[model samples]
Target chain A: MQTVQTIITDLKDKPGALLPILHAVQNSLGYVPPEIVPTIAKALNLSRAEVHGVISFYHYFRDHAPGKKTVRICRAESCLAMGGKALESQIKTKLGIDYHETTEDGNYSLEAVYCLGNCACSPAIQIDNDVYGRVTAESFNEILTEQSA
Target chain B: MSITVYVPCDSSAVSLGANRVANAITQEAEKRGVEINVVRNGSRGMYWLEPMVEVATDNGRIAYGAVKTGDVASLFDANFLNGGTHALNLGLTEEIPYLKKQQRLTFARVGITDPVSVEDYVAHDGYRGLKNALSYSQAEIVKHVSDSGLRGRGGAAFPTGIKWNTVLNTPSEQKYIICNADEGDSGTFSDRMIMEGDPLVLIEGMTIAGLAVGATQGYIYLRIEYPHALEILNAAIANATAANYLGENIQGSGKTFHLEVRQGAGAYVCGEETALMESLEGKRGLVRFKPPLPAISGLFGKPTVVNNVISLASVPVILDKGGEFYRDFGMGRSRGTLPLQLAGNLKHAGLVELAFGATLREVLYDFGGGSATGKPIRAVQVGGPLGSYLPESQFDTPLDYEAFAAIWAVLGHGGIVAFDETVDMAQMAKYSMEFCVEESCGKCTPCRIGSTRGYEVMDEIVNKRDLDKNIPLLRSLCDTMLNGSLCAMGGMTPYPVLSALNHFPEDFGIKAA
Candidate 1:
């Protein structure tokens, strides 16, 4: 029930307020609602195209609703060296989804990230807020089970 | 007095199950009715033995690492509270060769102090640089950094002091200081470590930059990938502000500086300064042409100073110890310590903060201890995805900036990702192009088009569709991307592709041309 007005009211005065406002909207609503774009543009005095342009540019902001949990798998060099490629393939198979796609049950969404800044522990994956490292196929399932339980 | 047990709260360590181990230790302590004070510290950078639990005994902090949740009860059973013998005991934390040999100048407070505690930070000589800066003139502060020979640790290797000097001399009613914490590089994590471990140091450094350049407002443009770093940095900023070390009239110096953390929507190109500013302006993360550098016409079109986390973090130490003290550590123009992050198929993949003169062989064998898979290390990629893939023959090259440049490689961000013999260099080269295609801001056509073309050519080469024609075509495409591109995204993509071809052409189903 978080409205665009609530997100923009506090942020409109700050310099470069669009990003923070967009982040706030996405954070609360789980996605940047397309209908709210006109409202955001009006509040920030930006054109609808300008607001739409920004939302589409960055990969983090999603226009549509997301699955309950976003699964980001590391696709960077360090992780790739430590079996990240395999892990990526395994996770894709397990979840039955590719990058940017949500599961049919709306329980999971897969993403391909370059690096998680956890290079020391390669083959890292972030399930929502928690990042798991040295993640084998088995450990990945264990994590899901532990979380859902 | 309760016995103190230190557990890492570092994101990397947490990713490796440190949180579980911490919870287990707390529950085990409660079960045993042991009066223990568990302090969550940052990682010591020895990641292979992460979840490195430390106990403060009369001797010193003894280390036990790679600890699991199941190992907690046994640790208590063995009375590890007194630093007793345990199978996982790593003796004194300082005595470990991997950590002991590291001249941890910037990382001195990391893993040792409570991250969010300002008191702990001050006790570990954290704000000494800012305290020292308050006593000197702005010119003196800039001079200290210049004399230290500190370059942009975010891979550009641009002189930090020169950037500050430009901003300092620029006359502007409202100047800004932006810390580029958008660490998008594949094999690097030192910036993340600093932000997560000793965030105050970066805050102190940014404050010093603000003081040096007469900027009243500062913003850390951190990437969205690091949620833990975001939390830690926010907490540290709040804590620092509370201590009067960050806000108006900092430390009663009557000088005002306000700091804020701005999250970047996941765009790799935003790591570029101009794109970063563009992103900061709530626009697309597109690269802008130079001549009016960030110091000249930066964020909000005002005189601004943009610095990397490591370069900014290094400032506090440079100010604390005179420039000469830091300058004397490393060789040539690359003075002071470089916290080299060794990763990917390395047995001891961690942070090794050594001086400039160390060779790649020393880092790979002496520090890294060879491949994690027990295979001979074949190709090592330094810098990030843009860095060249060096062969074993070039391993003897010293880690100095000039030396790396002489070998057609870069010491970019001091991130070394090693690949074993089983790695297909052709695939890696292809991935580099793909990464460029994915990350390109699309401001320039060369990077955008050339990357896709590069991927197509590599696919042809990989599949042996037309090795002879496609190989030369790949070189031509690389040449176009190298010169035609607007920024490093296109310009440096050739490094990995060409280097992979030059060094491991056999993998591409062809001999070196």
Candidate 2:
């Protein structure tokens, strides 16, 4: 596994290197550690404040570690036009966690995304990189069970 | 006998279980001891029949659609490998009514070929435009586009030639061509389709822009939501580079252009050209005030040519078929076709690339097949999140940019999200403001603070608390955001809110104004 220093060292020279660096760190480690902020800032000749600001401003980045699986439900208008809200409530109840909350067992972390570009088949949700469509509450439970099994 | 089969790998098709269908077909073929070849192609945009399987036959590619894993065995038993009778069969892929009825200049090769195959792309007339562009001088190239009357399809509808012309005139040692692939609009997926389905076209388009404007480097700032598109684009880039369609000295022409894909961390505001540049620079996604437009001082303070995915993608066709030939398709100042995405509550939802001037009513009933619930489609939100919501009364309006503007509506990005009669306009209005608040980059006071206040006032309006006061207050706040916000993020947020409040006041507990 490439360490945080190596990721920063590799990407620091690219123009507008901050977002790409943060994405690389997050993608590999699942979260950007606050401790590495100073190191990243030093490599990029940016202040720790500037680096921290960039990390916090974008919704996709996170400073803390997430659960084993992160579930992002689309809450945009297209999803809402379908039964997304109802499905959202069912998932929250099933996992015992609301949006942005992690389950006690760290099995799941819930988040809301605006759109997954599956508008034609609305009420979409993405787990990691895989997006599912026309998902009802019942199907979601089945999908979750299948993935875990 | 070795038979060819196409299973869509387009992300939307995958979302609808295309992958499972693909796996089933392969496994079934092996089980039957039959020689078969499987091609993971892009979508046909007929999503209602997704998991749609096509077989290469004497009558062209026959389509079997909305196929499930359970149905795969039956299909093989029915001799579907030879395009035999099947309950799910939808006839020749090109003959589908929904697909054949409209123009498809920009999306010509999208669902028709292997997304990353350079040879397939060349066979389908992919690089003809770039090759034609290579022969012309930079000014002549710009004039061809200018004469084609291609406007930005990324919602702003700015003339593409004007933006390119400005960048061409500005002398700079370093110039950048940025393709805004950060398509964060809730109801739009045309950009995603082009990237995942025919990425080589975009590569060709960007390469042409680089050659025309004297820029050597180009970047596609794609949103992270499109992980599938990212994968396809990178693969296509590599394939194009290896084929000399991209990278330095293309086909030994001596002109060099390098392309890279930059992933955005999900900021809606970054769709704005200036904010996109700011985010690209590894800073907070904030809007920059423009006196020196992006064409003059952009991307590291050098001349930049920033265009939407559709605008750049359309360039190849304009060049391939002369500008006048391209200009002959649409109405008014809006030239060429727009890849209209029918989403939300619509039945048979998918992408329809049509010439401008089609009435919204014709689209709703003719292409859309009305609402999915079989009820009346009460509202249609054209464009993306910030676009205005038009009631059924306004359905007769043509889709021209100027025509839509006559009613204060915009054909923004050509994404039409329908809502059935059961939808509550008040709730939709509230979500619009809420979306603004969630995605605002907080660069200026009007957008950052105004959106927050707009959301609150909407909450008050929805709750019927101080209705008279709240309604007036919401409008005032919208005024502030419209005039004061630095970019469209803040400026356009009111389009939905006000359009909702004005068009469907009954839902807001008031009579229509």
Candidate 3:
């Protein structure tokens, strides 16, 4: 396994390498582990506070591992105009988990994203690497069920 | 002879099942023993017609849209390969009124070419600007841009020429050109469109900037939400590099320019130049105070030219067509076309690239066909989230910088998000402050603390607690944040809050005072 330290080593040569390193760590490990903060700080020659600050400042970086599936729902004005509020409620009800919560079964994790630049096809959602647009409550349920299966 | 079919590789198009539609078409063609050339093109900016497939016919390319996988077989059955009519048929693509009326200067080849094909890009006058630029002195190139009257498309409306001139004049051992692709605004996607559609234009634009400014290195600070764009951009970069359009000694000009794409973590504040630079440095995205402008000292304390994607992408055209050609399009000091993004409740939500001075009424009614919900549009928030919410009474306001300013509003980033009468202005006001709180860099007290206080006050007003007191408090807090904030993130947060309060007082449960 390529450890977080090794990932940091590969990216350390670049300018302003911390964000990329953190992104790499998250991509590889599913989240930036608290245990590796000190390691990253020492490797980058920055304070642990600095590393932690960078990690926490961006909403994309997660401190903990997500569930089997991570779903990001667009919460920006475009989505809001297209009944995104209803869709959010429906998703929460379906998974029994609110934003930033993982399902008890460890099958799903939900997060709110500002915009996905798919405003034309409003009420967009991203599940892992795939983005879906013009999502409805029924369609969302179908997508979740299909992904879970 | 194999018939050519065009399908969008645009991220938003893909999100709407353009990928699946493309796959189904290919599979259907193979199964039917028909030869077809499926070319992945970029979106036409008519997103409502997405998954919009085009067929090259003698009458010009014909379009079929809102396609589904199940419709693919039937499409072939109807002889769609030869521009056959079907239920989804939209006739000739260019003849479509929504796209035909608007001027497409910057996005001339966007949806018209294979984005990764350097040959196809060049065929459509892609490298002409770079070729023209190679012949000119750096000052001449800057002069041409200045004469074009191009302003920054990224909401600020700063003269593109003046900024380039400053960077050209600023002597530095290490100068940088940073293309701010961190388009975090909600209603805009033109940046993403241009990047994914005709990436070579942006590369050519950046290369021109490098040659003009004597910079050898450039970075595109792309937003994290655009994974699809990132993939397309990286591939395009590699293709350009392989073709010697990028890297050292580009096209035998003896000039060296290297370009790299850096991903931004999800932070709206990073769209601001100073904060973007700070974030690019691998630090917290904190907004820096002005004294040493980015043109003088930026990107590792070296003189850097930071421009928005649209601003940079528009350069190739300006260079190719001469500055006066572009300058002839618009009205007043706000010259050149504005690629206005019509989104939210608009019936025909898409990109409308037109010369400046198109009224809000023309955009909303003529181009957009009014609200999608068929209800009366209560408000339209122009220039992204920070822009003011305009009522119908203000619809006659021309989409000019000064015209918008005259109305106490801004034409920031050219994004117009419409909201129907059902929208609650109080809730929108609350979300504005809440978004500020969430995305604020915490560098200044006004934005950091004021946003939270504003949200609380809006909450109280919505909840009908201390309406008389909290209303005045919110206004005062907005004033302080507007005056004391370090950047536009704090300063412009008041635009939405106050506009909502002023325009639609009924939604806030208050009588129009």
Per-model TM-score on C-alpha atoms: 0.99, 0.99, 0.99
lDDT of 1 at B120: 97
- The lDDT, on a scale of 0 to 1, for candidate 2 is 0.92
Q: Compared with the true structure, what per-residue lDDT tens digits does model 3 show for residues B191-210?
A: 99999999998999999999
Report the lDDT tens digits of candidate 1 across residue range B1-513. 899999999999998889989999999999989899999898899999998999999999999988999999999999999998999999999999998888989898899999999999999888999999999999999999999998888888899889999999999999999999999988999999888889999999999999999999999999999999999999999999999999999999999999999999999999999999999988889899897888888999999998899999999999999888889998988899999999998999999999889999999998899999999999999999899999999999999999999988999988999999989999999999999989999989999999999988888888988887999999999999999999999999999999999999899898666
Q: Candidate 2, TM-score vs. the true structure?
A: 0.99
lDDT of 2 by residue, B310-373 (tens): 9999999998987898899999999888889999998989999999989999998999999898
lDDT of 3: 0.93
lDDT measured at residue A123 in model 3 versus the true structure, 0 to 100: 83
lDDT, model 1, position B71: 94
Clash pairs, candidate 3, are B155-B413
Worst 10 residues of 1 chain A by lDDT: A1-10
What TM-score does chain B get in every candidate?
A: 0.99, 0.99, 0.99
TM-score of chain A of each: 0.97, 0.96, 0.95
What are the C-alpha RMSDs, in order, of all predicted structures? 0.9, 1.0, 1.0
DockQ of each: 0.88, 0.89, 0.83
**Residue A46 in model 3: shift from native, Å?**
1.0
